[model samples]
Target: MEKFKITDLDLYYGTFKALIKVNLTIEANQITAFIGPSGCGKSTLLKSLNRMNDLIEGCRIDGNVLLDGEDIYGNIDVNLLRKRVGMVFQKPNPFPMSIYDNVAYGPRTHGIHSKIKLDEIVETSLRNAAIWDELKDRLKKSALGISGGQQQRLCIARALAVQPEVLLMDEPTSALDPISTSKIEDLISELKERYTIIIVTHNMQQAVRISDKTAFFLLGQVIEYDTTENIFSNPRQKETEDYITGRFG
Candidate 1:
């Protein structure tokens, strides 16, 4: 099933075009990585998936973004759309609360009032994120008190707690230590069994390691998109070959 279809997508920030006629199909229950150099609109295109650009005062979009065959930008509710497509940033941003509260925040906001229900949801989400065993005894501790790797896992748990159908990650492992980065990469592989994931990563090795499909971006355009093996080993375009071979970024 197709999770998202972005067609002729163009984005602007006060007359500066950020994305130029970008098109792609993101499949359900798979990991798609967006790789490119700086200022290439990788993150810009990721944010557009859930309409995060709407937060910017003068940002505008000219395109069609379909989520499950429905036009998300046309008449869909932004708040509801966001719930279905959750986002996690480069940094581990846990609210200044207990670990349990951090994971339960989304469900509570969406009107889940029963204690047992919240407990069940939090436990399931943490386990799915592969951090439940590590933090099971520290549920009441401040989220800030945890280690960086644990904190990043906590953020992932928090996003999963919402039971989102799609998860968008922007440089999710860039701020972590080597071990933490590996853990997150492993988690991404496991996550593709349930939720569709789209990640913007500058680390070519990481993209090759975790993603099933790879999309290479250059100067706000999609240069090449195909299976990870093909994009890295047998690119159809010279630009993609040059970028991957370290000849040019």
Candidate 2:
């Protein structure tokens, strides 16, 4: 099942073209990773999926981005589009509130106010993110007080609370230590069974470890996109081969 289909997409920030003629199909219930060196437009394309680029001034896009066969750049409500496609940033960004409140925030925003319903949503979301057992006792404690990895999982739980169909992660483990990154990697492996995931990572190993498919980008263009095995073992393009072999990014 195709989750998102991007067609002839071009994005620009002022006079600088950030993405050119980008086209890709993201599958449902699988992990798709975008891997490239810094400033290669990997993250730029990620942001375009959920229209986060709209928040930036002078940012413009040409072409179509479809979510579940419907045009996301068309008349779809932006807020509803965001609800269906939640995002976790590069850094762990929990709200300045308790752990329970952090998980409950999205549900509340979507008009879920009953205490019973909210509690169920929070618990289920945390469990889905593989963090309920660790944080159940500290539900009332401040989220910022948690460890970096735990905080990232908490952010994942928060996104899950919104019942999103796709989760977009932007270098979610860049700031975490090895142990924390490992935990997130495991969680992502588990998450693909239920929700479609698209992640932007500079860590090729991480991409290889967790992603089912990989897209290699360069200078605002996708050089290659294929199964993780093919992309890592036998990439077709010399650019992809060179990048994978660490010859050049």
Candidate 3:
């Protein structure tokens, strides 16, 4: 049930190397978290999952990032790859349009124009994101009008509307308050039943609470990768132990 197999993956932004010899296997329908301090390669590696880093200027990659045994960095249609692997950013970035339009955007972009199908997709996506009950009556309202947590959930709904197999979240709850953060945390746990989730987070507690596996990154390298319990409670690496004990990041 391996969803992704990354082998000797190295990434660079112009002259600076962001990731070095990164190797990991992400399994199907499980939550894997990338944890580290700022400037670590966690986020860079997350973006590389769907080739999102390709948008950056002078960004270069070597080695293989495979999804379902096919190399994503090899000969493949980038757009289709992206559709299969959706992403949500650190901040809640709902489109300026109405809520319904926001959720329907991806399906529409992929040529799902039938209103009947769109309605079903929108409802299912919102429900999957755990925001349908809250936003059901306000579908026509502008997405910007919602609160930060609601907006973040809405963004998740938007990602789900595309029917992606993998969901890549980059510090998705970092911009929210404690209450909002908890809600999104719960949502993330539920999501792993359907999609293989890879989240980059600075919150070790959150990672322990939600992720099945954890990868601790430091200075562009993964110091340790293991089950969440082992990573938090019995980490083999001194750097990981130090990090979990709050001795240093």
Candidate 4:
């Protein structure tokens, strides 16, 4: 049930090396968290999984990032790869259009043009994001009009609309209130039953709350990776113990 296998990954932007030799295997239908301080390259590694770094001007990767045994950097359709692996950013970035349109956008791009099909996909995606009941009545309204938390959930719904197998979340709840953060945390926990989730989070408590596995990143390297319980309770590395114990990040 391995979803991703990364080995000897080294990423760079122009002259600066951003990530060092990294190796990890992400399992299927589980939540894996990348936690570290700012500029530790956790987010860079997350973006690398789906090839989001390709958009950067001088970004280069010298390593293997395999998705389901196939090299993602190999001869493959990038669009199709992206369709199967969706991402949600730190802030909720809903389209200026209606909520329904936002959810239907992915299916539409992938050639699902029928209204009936789009409607079903929209509703189902919203339900999967745990926001259908909240937004069903407001599908025609501008997505920008919703609260920040609702907007984030809508973004999640949009990611789900593509029927992706893996969902990459980059600090998904950082911009929300405590109540909103809790709601999204619950939603993410529920999502692991269907999608393999890799989240880059600065919040250690959030990782402990939802992730099945935790990978601690520092100085552009993964210091330790293990079950969340082990990483938090019985860490093998002094650095990990220092980090989890609030000694230093």
What's model 2's overall lDDT?
0.95
Clashing residue pairs in candidate 2 are none
Residue 196 displacement in candidate 1 (angstroms): 0.3
lDDT of 2 by residue, 1-249 (tens): 999999999999999999999999999999999998889999999999999999999999999999989998898899999999999999999999999999999889889999999999999999999999999999999999999999999999999999999999999999999999998999999999889999999899999999999999999999999999999999999999999899983
lDDT for model 1 comes to: 0.93
Model 3, 1-249: lDDT tens per residue? 999999998899999999999999999999999998788899999999999999999999999999999999889999999999999999999999999999999999999999999999999999999999999999999999999999999999999999999999999999999999999999999999899999999888899999999999988898899999999989999998888788983
Error of 2 at 122 (Å): 0.6
In model 4, the runs with Cα more than 4 Å from the true position are none
* lDDT string, candidate 1, 76-109, tens digits: 8898888999999999999999999999999999
lDDT digits (tens) for residues 99-190 of candidate 4: 99999999999999999999999999999999999999999999999999999999999999999999999999999999999999999999
Global lDDT of each candidate: 0.93, 0.95, 0.95, 0.95
- Candidate 3 to truth, TM: 0.98
The C-alpha local distance difference test score for the whole of candidate 3 amounts to 0.95
Compared to the true structure, candidate 2 yields what TM-score? 0.98
